[model samples]
Target: MPRITYIEHDGTEHTVEVGNGLSVMEGARDNDIPGIEADCGGACACATCHVYVDPSWIGKIPAKDDAEADMLDFAAAPTSGASRLACQIRVGDHLDGLIVRMPETQG
Candidate 1:
């Protein structure tokens, strides 16, 4: 399992160990973290599972695909280079210390 840290917009932090093969959103959802809404489950159909990858992790995670990039346009906050949909990022040993920060809202 890989341990991931999820930070809320208000500065709350939750760290949990997530098994490999699950998406980052699933990690958050399963841990009962408050930030990521994951409206579309693990599908890339919605942007509700949006989060900003930590700057140190921007180059570590795989780049977001076209569909994920497009869906992010619907995220509540403005998207930047670090913006990513949690559903699109899979958990793995390489991401043991992955960190993500949720935006203020997810509509």
Candidate 2:
């Protein structure tokens, strides 16, 4: 399992051990971490699971695909270089201690 940390806009943080191969969005929802709406149920059809990848971990995660990039246009908050859909990030050993910052809102 990989340990992931999700930080809210107000500075609240939730840390949990996520099972390998599970999406980050699923990890958050399963652990009751607030902020990740995942309205599309990890299908990558919505931006509700948007998050900002920690700078240090930016190079670790895979680049966003065209579909995810398109969905980000609908995010409630402004998207930046760090913006990523949690549902697109799969948990793995290399992602241990990964930290993602949640925006103020998710459309």
Candidate 3:
């Protein structure tokens, strides 16, 4: 399992161990971490699970696909170079200490 840390807009942090093959959104939702609405349930159809990968981790994960990029346009908060949809990030050994910050709102 990989350990992931989720930080909220107010600086609240929730760290949890996520099983391999699971999406970051599932890890957050399963652990009851706030700010990751995951309204589309990891289907990549919505931006409710949007997050900002830690600057140091920006290159650790794969680039977002076209569908994810398009859906991000609907995110309530502005997207940045580090912005990513949690559902698109699969957990793996390399992401053991992955850290993502939640926006002020997910809409």
Candidate 4:
């Protein structure tokens, strides 16, 4: 299992345990976390599950492919680095303490 921490725009944080092999968006949604909308249900088509992965963990996370990269453009208040669509990040046993910062808006 992997434990993930989600930081909201207000600086509040929520941490939840997630199963390995599941997507970050699914982890948040399963835990009932408020920020991750996951409107497209892990399809790369929507950016509603956008999250800012901690800089220190950027190297630990996998790089996005062309499809996910294209979808990132739709995320509101986009960031060039550290921003990723949670649906594209799969939870793994090694990511026991992953942390993600949520942005204020998402389409």
- The Cα RMSD in angstroms, rounded to one decimal, for candidate 1 relative to the true structure is 0.8
**Which pairs of residues collide in model 2?**
none
| lDDT assessment of candidate 3 | 0.93
Write down the TM-score for model 2.
0.96
What TM-scores do the predictions have? Answer: 0.97, 0.96, 0.97, 0.96
The TM-score measured for candidate 3 stands at 0.97
Q: Which ten residues in a row have the lowest lDDT in candidate 1?
A: 73-82
Residues 1-107, model 3: lDDT tens digits: 89999999999999899999999999999999999999889999989999999999998899988999999998887567888999999999999999999999998
The lowest-lDDT stretch of 10 consecutive residues in candidate 2 is 72-81
Error of 1 at 62 (Å): 0.5
User: lDDT, candidate 4, residue 1?
Assistant: 71
Error of 4 at 73 (Å): 0.6
Residue 95, candidate 4: C-alpha displacement in angstroms: 1.1
Stretches of candidate 3 exceeding 4 Å from the true structure: none
lDDT tens digits, residue span 1-107, model 1 = 89999999999999999999999999999999998888889789988899999999999999988999899889887568889999999999999999999999898
Model 2, 1-107: lDDT tens digits are 89999999999999899999999999999999999999889999889999999999999999989998898898877557799999999999999999999999886
